[model samples]
Target: MENMHIVFWLLKDISWCMIWKPLGVAMIFPTLIISIVIAWRTRQFMSELCHNVAISVWISANSYWMISEFFHFDEHHIWGGITYKHLALIPFITGLLILMYFYLWWQPRNKEETEIIEA
Candidate 1:
C-alpha cells in the first residue's frame, strides 16, 4: 500500500511537472486518500503517525499549488505580496510544526512510554 502510495504521488508530481491538468487534478484524490489511510492505519505508532500526517499535508499543499497553476491564478496576489501559491505554505508550515512538536516535545517526553508500549 505504501509503495502504491508512492506511485500515485509520483504520478501526481509528474503530471504537475508536465502541466497535465486533468491527470494532475485526478491524481489528488488517490494520493491524498492513500496517505490519509496510511496515517489512520499507523495511528498507534507516534512516529509513523507524524510522518504519515506530514505526507498527507504535503500532498494537499502540492495539489493546491498545482491547481492554482493549472487555472492560472498562482501569481495573482491575494494579500500583500502573497499569491495563491503562497497559500500552500499554510499546510507546509503546519506539517513542519507537527514534526517539530513530535521531535522536540512529545517524543522526548514520551520516550519511555513509547518504548514500553513497543515492548
Candidate 2:
C-alpha cells in the first residue's frame, strides 16, 4: 500500500511537471487517500501516527501547490504580499508543527510508551 502511494505521488508530481492538468488533478485523490489510510492504520502508535499524519498534510500542501500552478494563480497575490502559492504554507507549517510537537513534547514525555511500542 505504501509503495502504491509512492507510485501515485510520483505520477502526480510527474504530471505536474509535464503540465498535464487533468492527470495531476486526478492523482491527488489516490495520493491523499492512501496517506490518510496509512495515518489511520498507524494511529495506535503516537510516533507513527504523527509521522504519517504529517506526511498526509505535506501531500495536501503539495497537491494544493500543484493545483495553484495548474490554474495559473500561484503567483496572484491574495493578501498584501502573500500569493496563492503561499497558501500552501498553511499545511506545510502545520505538518512541521505536528512533528515538532511529537518530537519536542509528546515523545519526550512518553518515552516509556514509545519504548514499549517498539518492543
Best by TM-score: 2
Q: Which TM-score value belongs to model 2?
A: 0.96
Candidates' C-alpha lDDT: 0.93, 0.97
Model 1 stretches astray by more than 4 angstroms: 114-119
Off by over 4 Å in 2: none
Per-candidate TM equals 0.94, 0.96
lDDT, candidate 2, 23-96, per-residue tens? 99999999999999999999999999999999999999999999999999999998899999999999999999
For candidate 1, write residues 1-119 as lDDT tens digits: 99999999999999999999899999999999999999999998888899899989999998999999999999999999989899999999999998998889898999997788668
Task: Assess the local accuracy of residue 92 in candidate 1 as a C-alpha lDDT between 0 and 100.
Answer: 94
- lDDT value for model 1: 0.93
